[model samples]
Target: MEDKKKILLVDDEESITRTLKLFLDRRGGFEVRTENRGSQAVRVARDFRPDLIVLDVVMPDSDGGAIAQDLGEDPELQSIPIIFLTAIIKEQEIGGHGKAIGGGVHTYLAKPVEPDVLISHIQERLGV
Candidate 1:
């Protein structure tokens, strides 16, 4: 039997996290855990050991990019793929260290993301 895929989803907004978690848990075919603080993301990711992390780039405490950088720097969590969810990106221009989507993100999904699209991206990135 295959192992169940675990996904850690972080967003500062309670409503967004709650709604996303419900849809993700119901149909996303993975164990999804939602965290509402960016500062705690690394700790949760370290403990949860999720195969993928759905990160929000605009949290008030700590931006997702900083969390991503920390996760990338940590050997235990570096291999986990990160997908940035945000509303800050209103343009299509790409720029970053690797220069993709205007910053350091594996993929960017704009705010008000549909449940199906979110699940699809999770499946695609996580190979679930």
Candidate 2:
């Protein structure tokens, strides 16, 4: 066996993190670490060095799209793929998320997401 794919989940809500953490870690073969604030995501990522990140698009101080840009710009963190999760985004607003942060993330997932769906995306993206 090898090291599990580390994942950092950033959300401002505790329930979402708790719920998703269980699914992503147990079934997805991932070591899931979570942050309940958007502002803390970058710092946590620096320390966690997760293979993949699931970020909440709408947060208290900052949004996931902005966080992704910050990570994408850094040479050390750029290669780590991010999946944006949002509740309010309409179908038409999906593609332009890249433009908001001036760059594109690996994938975007909607909020109230099913456990299996999120797990599937994680497996597919991290190849776990």
**Best candidate per TM-score, number?**
2
Q: After superposition, how far is residue 116 of candidate 2 from its true place, in Å?
A: 0.7
Model 2 lDDT at residue 23: 79
For the record, the alpha-carbon RMSD of candidate 2 to the native fold, in angstroms, is: 2.5
Q: Which residue pairs of candidate 2 clash?
A: none
Q: Relative to the unseen true structure, what is the C-alpha lDDT of residue 95 in candidate 1, on a scale of 0 to 100?
A: 29
Off by over 4 Å in 2: 90-102
Q: Rate the local accuracy (lDDT) of all candidates.
A: 0.79, 0.81
Expressed as tens digits, the lDDT of each residue in 35-82 for candidate 1 is 998899999998999999998989999997788888878888888877
lDDT of 2 at 126: 76
TM-score of each: 0.87, 0.88
Give the per-residue lDDT of model 2 (tens digit) for 1-128. 88888999999999989988987777886899999989989999999999989989899899887888899888889888787788886535564233435254467766666788777777777765
